[model samples]
Target: MYKNLTITSLLGALTIILGAFGAHALKKQLSVEAMQSFETAVRYQMYHVLVLLVINLYDGFSEKMKRTLTLLFTAGILFFSGSIYLINLFGVSAKSIWFITPLGGLLFIMGWSLLFYKFLKISLQK
Candidate 1:
């Protein structure tokens, strides 16, 4: 878990660095829509990165929260950021797939919700 956290932190740092580069360097080349998409991806990636950090802090917790958080964090990265990057790279203009981004956000919310529930359950058990 510690190793995973460290790796995730590194990945998050890379995401931030690349996000900045995309904003400053590629701004002129990318259209407004693409830029917006990129920013959206960056925003969600950073959000989940912080979420992972919080999960890492609770290392001694039960297995349920650990699994849920891991899945959610991975989904957020693969779906949320992945979709945006794909749209930007491929210039897909139909926008029907915009739904995926929200789904990813929903997954993130669900992950946090489960974490909250777990903490509540644990606290109440005491």
Candidate 2:
């Protein structure tokens, strides 16, 4: 839990930094579309990190459950947000890694599905 808290905190900080950098440093340099995409990446990353912070702090979840969700979300952030950053900031062609972005989105969906399943299972057990 502490590990996740630390990781989530760092990701949160990075999200803020990246957001500021996007709004200021890259605003004039990037096309409007690129800027929007970058903002999307930042939003997704920050959103998941916020969820992760809650998960880590909430004692309702077991350590194993927290770990699993963290793994899925962290992987999703890396692949989803990281790919967008690569494309917009580094000029990487989207075609070169066509499968990655979708795969990351799939990971994010899977994480949410797992949470839903866990809650349903718990409620049914009651």
- The candidate 2 region of ten consecutive residues with least summed lDDT is 51-60
**Predicted candidate 2 versus true structure: per-residue lDDT over 7-116, tens digit per residue:** 99999999999999999999999999999999999999999999999888988899999999999999999999999999999999999988888889999999999989
Instruction: Enumerate residue pairs that collide in model 1.
Output: none
Could you give me the TM-score of model 2 versus the true structure? 0.97
List runs of model 2 lying over 4 Å from the truth.
none
True-structure lDDT of candidate 2: 0.95
| Predicted candidate 1 versus true structure: per-residue lDDT over 48-80, tens digit per residue | 888787787775675566666877886867777
Residue 73 displacement in candidate 1 (angstroms): 1.8
lDDT of 1 at 45: 85
Question: Ten consecutive residues with minimal summed lDDT in candidate 1?
Answer: 59-68
